[model samples]
Target: MKNSREIIVDILLKVEKEGTYLQLLLKKELDGFESLDKSFITEVATGAMKRQITIDYIINEVSTIKINKMKPFIRNLLRMSVYQLKYLDKIPAHAVIDEAVKLTKKKGYATLTKFVNAVLRNVDRQDIILPDDDLSVKYSIAPWIIDSWSVTYGPVIAEKIANELSANRAKVSARINTLKTTKTDLINFLVNESVIPLPGNIYPDEYLYLNGVNDIASMKSFAEGLFTIQDESAGIVSHVVNPLAGEYILDLCSAPGGKSTHLAQLSQNQANIISTDIFEHKIDLVKKNASRLGAGSICAELYDEKDIDKFVGRFDKVLIDVPCSGLGLLKRKPDINFNRNEYHIAQINATQKSIAKTAASFLKPGGSLVYSTCTLNKTENELMVDYISALGLVPDCTLIDYVPDMFKEFVSGGHVTIFPFVANTDGFFIAKFKK
Candidate 1:
């Protein structure tokens, strides 16, 4: 078996050269490893990716070779080794250098092993200086993202968002499945299982922080459909829409069924919900989640744009959690920060507006329409609200009493912008309206 360090270097090389998502690539490479080994690879790989700019900065300052000019393998090997040496204090510096040298020789680059050893050995991590004035490089986020956010939130707040995004451990939140069990019941079960779970500050009744749990899905409570993994921000959208017992709810862009199944579970599996996505395979995922959670009322479908005709004026609440730049979720999915560009954000904004417009026709007069995104871009959040309002929907124009009192300052024009650094939740924007 390849040691953990070698496997991490191989995965980081692919991530740099081929552009695979960090989590997806790690998951593929880590199959069947003991949990401890998997955890170590996850740390170093994600750490290196999250702090790509800073690691590259440290390497460039020390090495004669420019980062871009080196072979992909050598560059990634140095990047990972440097990340551990600088960030991982538990592992002694000599041990990190030793493993990196061995891995370099085994990759058929025996000639360069000493070269690797020399650079790592001589470079003093403390001497490395990050570009303090250049917020983009300091945080390893693309300049466009920093520029866009800085334009709205100002430079300081933008840097704060970037710092939160670069944080190593992303918080995990889950929702109790009310269909099969109560929140109190689920909490008791979790405690009995030796996993320390606590209610979330935002949505205490429904969402729980997975405090001491490492592998959540493997828990017996999870296997029994007692809860499902969901971020607190995403979990709150179901409450914003607030389906009553038999109301019809439509999630126009539902996929992987997080919001759709939550709505079903919230209604005790009695609400009528049609959860559809643009793709067939994603709809299959919704089906799988609905079945596993026993949310039988959630009907998953391969969406047909023409189906809008059938759904028109037929639902009580509609959730257009249309996709956006996903800037809000950067902390949880660090690869997202690297994946998006200016054109991609514009393209997704157009698509988001298009979906919100179409979803409104599905709501009856006076029916609630919750427009939301895991994004901070105003063009996609507040401006989209304006477009939907012009479509004859009336904005609620007040913060719901249940919204975390802490975000009172951000509650403007009936919408809330939750920043990860500010709210300790995934960055999210939510707007409620009545058609």
Candidate 2:
């Protein structure tokens, strides 16, 4: 069996070669590991992934062979090792070097052990000097991302966003399934199960900030439809919709059904909701989540855009959590930093416009529609808001009145962009309109 460090190297290499998501890969690699080992693996792998560019910059400063020229195995092995030497203050330097050397020998690169050892030692001894002009190298974000954010938001705020996203160990937040259990009852149940539950910064009554629960899906409470994992910022979107009992709602592009399930609970499981996704597998995910959360009122369906005429003018509220560049999710999904680019953003922006046009068409006259994305880009956010407004739907400024007081400062003109640094949540944008 492979040890933790070997698993870390494998996770990093797969991310680079296969373009897989870091979190998903890490989860798959973590089964059967002890709790402490799982924690260590999670920390080092995610830390290394988040700081890839920075780690590479430091490696190139010390090694004769730049990171790009090294074999994939050697490059990733050095990357994870260097991450420990530079970032993890608790680990002894000798231990990190010893493990790297042993892994090189075990992986059949015995000849390169000395090379790995010398580079890691040099990395430890070298003075870390980051570029003053390039925030991307320092913050470990893609250059275009940093530059675009700097132009959209000021350089200072953009730097702040980069620094915050680069930071490790994002908190996990979950909402109680009201249909299955009350908040008080769920808290008692979680306490007995050895999971620590704290009040959330926003919606403290409904959401709990969870800790010490490594594998939430394996818990009996989760299987019993007691709660669903969601970020606090994502939970806020359902509040913006403010669905009431007996209202008809359409959640276009709902998958794994976070907001759709929340809307069902918000409306006392009385609102008629149709959760639709383009893929059959994703629709199955929505169905599974809805069933698990006791949100049986939610109807999951395969969405065919060509058959749009049936959904037109049929709902009281429409939610299009449109697919985005996922720039806002850097802290949780570090692979996004490596995978996304400007050209991809432009392509997704057109898809966002198309989805919004369809979502607007779903609402009845005077019905409300909420357009949201977990990305921070203007082209996918503010510009898309304008495009929807041009469709003759007026911006519903009253959405601000429902926003929690903690997030009120971020709201302007009834639209809010929750920056990770400022709002302490995923970087998200939301705007509401009436058809």
Candidate 1 residue-wise lDDT, 58-103, digit = tens: 8888788889988889998998988888888888989988988888
Clashing pairs in 1: none
Q: Per-residue lDDT tens digits of candidate 2, residues 1-435?
A: 999999999999999999998889987999999989998999999999999999999999989998999999999999999999999999999999999999999999999999999999998887878997889898899998998899988898899899888864578888988999989999999999999999877778888988998888789999998999998889889999999988999999899899999999999899999999999999999999998888978999999978989999999999999999999999888899888998899899888988888788888999999999999998998888789999999989998888877768878775888888865678899999998
Q: Which TM-score value belongs to model 1?
A: 0.94
Best by lDDT: 2
Off by over 4 Å in 1: none
Task: Tell me the whole-model lDDT of each prediction, alpha carbons only.
Answer: 0.83, 0.90
Clashing pairs in 2: none
